[model samples]
Target: MKTLGVIAGREMRLALRNRSILITAAIFAIWFPVMSAFGVVAGAGGDAATIAGGIAAITIPVGIFMGYIFCADAFLREKRDGTIETLLCTPVSLRRLWEGKAIGVAVPAYVMTLISATVTIAAISTIAGITVVTEPLLLLHLATIVPVWIVASAGLIGAAQLALGMRENQILGFLLIFGFIFIIIGLQEVAPGGPGISPVTEGILAVAGIALVAFARFTAGRVTRERIVLTIP
Candidate 1:
């Protein structure tokens, strides 16, 4: 438990220091929300559910999506620089390391996601000339569902980075981006000529998120230092 916390803390500090991570965080935290609000502006104005859905559609994905955007190199970079070997020699178990790194990547991104969601809601409501009130389902999604998604996403992707080769990891990163993009587009389009994710949709999101968490745990059990080291370039 202490080892996991230490690794998570170390990764958080490293993420804060990384120029690319900061830049990416800034872009999504500042620009993506405004852009999404604009994209869905027509239906979002003065509708709580629409507003909440639009906000979730954009902001919820920020944490999980950006988790990989930043952690695509979680193990790949370590391997490239010969640090994976050092980590392998450490007393930390592979599963613990995987969980720690996932939490490390997910935590900061989750904070940024919260900030982005708040900013988007405020900006969108102000633009629409109305009070912003999130629907219960949407609010739940932002507060609970999104964070779960982030954990699941980061855990799975981080584990894969350790288990897969560099080329495979790169390919996985691309696939994740594309898949999220598709989900975003689909959610926006399916919101009934508006911006809200319905209760039913949010339910689906919750189920899917839980499933992903289970999948990540399954993947974590399969990660081994030998395979990670053998595949290192």
Candidate 2:
């Protein structure tokens, strides 16, 4: 447990050193809420649910992009730079390393997600002067979104790096992710609406996220450059 915490702490510090991560955090913490409020005001006449839905719509994409930034290199960078070998040679088991890294990536995303959600919700309440109830369902949705985003972001990013890093075709991986996001947006339009729907959607997100985590784990444990190239071709 101590070893895992140390690993997680190290990754967290490295993420802090990255300017892009800081910039993204600032955007989510401050800019996103202000922009969401403006968008809601500009769109006008919608009920709070509709406005909230709109906010979620915008948030989902930004969330995915943020996920990419936060997670796309959870393991690939280490392997690329030969740090993985050093870590693997340490006393830490693969499971601990994976768990530690997962926590390292997810923790920041969770914090930033909460910050962004709070900012957006507060801004919306202030501007619309709407008596917003932070009801159980609303709270549930907020709670679920953070973990969902973390898993989805970590899984997708980790999988992409493992799958595409060999070809040095990272742009293709990003494009594919955006394509998936567009599909998700389109699907949301077709789905039946309400708070009840959030749980179901989150369940689906969790499934995909777990798959990615599994893939990351498997890749880290077993896959090699030769295997990656063979699989890609």
Candidate 3:
């Protein structure tokens, strides 16, 4: 537990020190929600359900995107510069290291998600001249489901970055970003009513997020130092 904290703290410090990454992430985190809220307010007229649905739609993708950005620094950069090899020589298990890294990344990413949600609510309220309150299901999605998804996303991406060559990781990164965009577009097309933030949808997404986290853990466990070393370039 102490080792995990130490590792997590290290990653957090690294993330904080990287001003460029922090600035980029903050911009996206703030930009997407504010813009979405504007569109929703203009079209939907400050309907609470519509606001909640809009928040739900944007927050998850933004959270995952933040995780994706940090994964490059947390996992890929270490492997690229050979620092991961030194960490591999330590007493900590690879799984713990990966978990710590994921936690570190997820914490900030989730915070950014919260910021995005808040900005969305504020923007909607400001534009429509009404106070905004999130629905219970939407609250549940933000409090639990979104963070879990961030961790799962970071863990999965970190595992892949550690196990793959630089070229492959670059390709994976591109695909991940585009994949999320396509998913959002598909959901909009399939459910024109907006992101349906019902109990059933939240429940299914929660289960899927948990399953993805477990899968990421399994994949991280399978990563060996030799495999990472061989893949480094």
Candidate 4:
């Protein structure tokens, strides 16, 4: 656990030192949530909670996708800088190191997502002269689903980055970005039809979230030190 903390701290420091990454993260983290909030409040002619829940269902994925962008360089940057080899030699096991790296990015992204959502809610309330969102489910999402989803995504992306060569990494990065774009588009198509928050849907998402984390853990285990070391140019 302590080893994981050290590894996580190192990743956070790296993220802080990269001005471009920080700026990009700031833009995406702030922009998407605010837009989603205002759009839902203005357009959705329904209960505030229901509208917020619908907005959240679609927008939360945007938050996770933004988190992925911030973490896209999680392993690629290390490999490019020639530090991954040295980091691999540290006392931490491969699984712990990878999980920590993902967690490090996930923690900050999740916090920013929460802050962005809260600020939007407050803004809507102030402007509309009514509480725009009082959804317990939206609260539940920010509390549980968002964090787990971010961590799982970062962990999987990190593991894949460590395992792939530079050319492959670049190709996949583009694919992942476009993939998220399509997902956002798809969400927009369905949201207008008014997706209900059935208990079954929530259950499926919870199960999927847990499965994603487990898949990440399994992938981390497969990211051998030698494979990563050899992949370094």
Candidate 5:
């Protein structure tokens, strides 16, 4: 646990120090929520469900974006610089290292998710002149499903970055960014009626998020030092 904490702390510090990345992430985290809030108010008149849906639409993607940007520094940069090889020589196992790094990235990403949610709620409240109170299910989604998805994404991306060559990571990164763009566009299309967050839908999302996390953990476990080293370059 101590080792994990140390590793997580180190990654957090590294992430913070990268001012360009930090600024870019901050912009996305703030901008998307504010825009989504406006669109919700304009189209849906800021009903609770609409506000919740708007916030939900932006929050998950912002969290994923944060994880995507940070994972490059947390996972790939280390490999590229050959620092990861030295870390691999330590007593800590690869899985723990992956967990620590994923947690580190996910923490900040989740914070950004919270920020996006807050911004959305505040914008909706202001624009529609009504207090924003989300549904219980939406609250549950923010508290549980969102964070799990962020962790899952970071863990899975980190595992892939560690296991793949530089060329592959670059290609994967491009695909991830474009995939996020498409997801946001798709959400925009469905967001007009607001997401029908029935209990069943919530359950399915929760289950899917948990399964993704488990899959990421399994992928990380399969990553060996030799594979990581061989892939480096």
Candidate 6:
């Protein structure tokens, strides 16, 4: 437990040192709401709810991007640099290392989203004034999206590392992330009133995304003939 926490903190520090994470979070933090506000003010876009919804839409891809960048690096960097083996030489277990790496990546991505979302919400609330009202339940529902993205990304990146060996896995992560958002949009458009409209849908999408990533990672882990046979037994 202590080791995982220490590893997690180290990961967080490493992420903070990286400029891309900061830049990505900052750009979206400023970009989405500003664009939404401009559209609202100029009669060019949507009301507050629409603006909020648009912001939510942007968040899905942004979440994926953050997850891919952070989690992919977390899962692959150790293997690529040979640090993972060195860590294994210590008393720390593989599961701890994996969980710690996931935490390291997830903590930053989650925090960045919280910051970005807060800024977006604040900006929208201030500018639009009384034009649009936000429901508490809606805000709560939206807040859950960040953690979901984090878990999904961790699973995807881990799987990519195990399955594609990192080198060939890059494009798939990007595609999967965007592809997810596209699917979400398409589903919403086609079946807005479908049974998939509940919080259950949210749970399913999140679980499915993370589960797919896990499957990829697990598949990679069991690629060896010995491991495959062991599972069968």
The lDDT values for all models are 0.76, 0.62, 0.82, 0.70, 0.80, 0.61
Checking candidate 5 for backbone clashes, the offending pairs are none
Model 6: colliding residue pairs: 159-217
What tens digits encode model 3's per-residue C-alpha lDDT throughout 66-89? 999888889988998999999999
Please provide TM-scores, in order, for all candidate models, with all chains considered together: 0.88, 0.73, 0.91, 0.83, 0.88, 0.72
Looking at model 2, residue 137 earns an lDDT score of 38
Select the stronger candidate by lDDT from 4 and 5.
5
For model 4, the stretches where C-alpha displacement exceeds 4 angstroms are 123-132, 177-198
> Deviation in angstroms for 159 in model 4?
0.6
> What lDDT score goes with residue 137 in model 1?
74
Which wins on lDDT, candidate 3 or candidate 4?
3
Off by over 4 Å in 6: 36-48, 130-134, 194-233
- Candidate 2: which stretches are off by over 4 Å? 41-46, 72-76, 91-96, 131-135, 166-169, 194-233
lDDT of 6 by residue, 108-197 (tens): 777766666666566666766633335443464456755766656665565555445444666777677777678666644554444222
In model 4, what are the clashing residue pairs, if there are any?
none
Badly placed stretches (over 4 Å) of model 3 are 180-194
Better of 1 and 4 by lDDT: 1
Model 6 whole-model lDDT (C-alpha atoms) = 0.61
Off by over 4 Å in 1: 180-195
Clash counts for all predictions: 0, 0, 0, 0, 0, 1
Task: For model 5, give the RMSD to the true fold.
Answer: 3.0
Strongest candidate by TM-score: 3
Q: List the residue pairs that clash in candidate 2.
A: none
Of candidates 6 and 3, the better by TM-score: 3
lDDT of 2 by residue, 85-200 (tens): 66766788766776677677776666776677677778877888864345443555556654665655565455556445556646755775676577556556555563223545
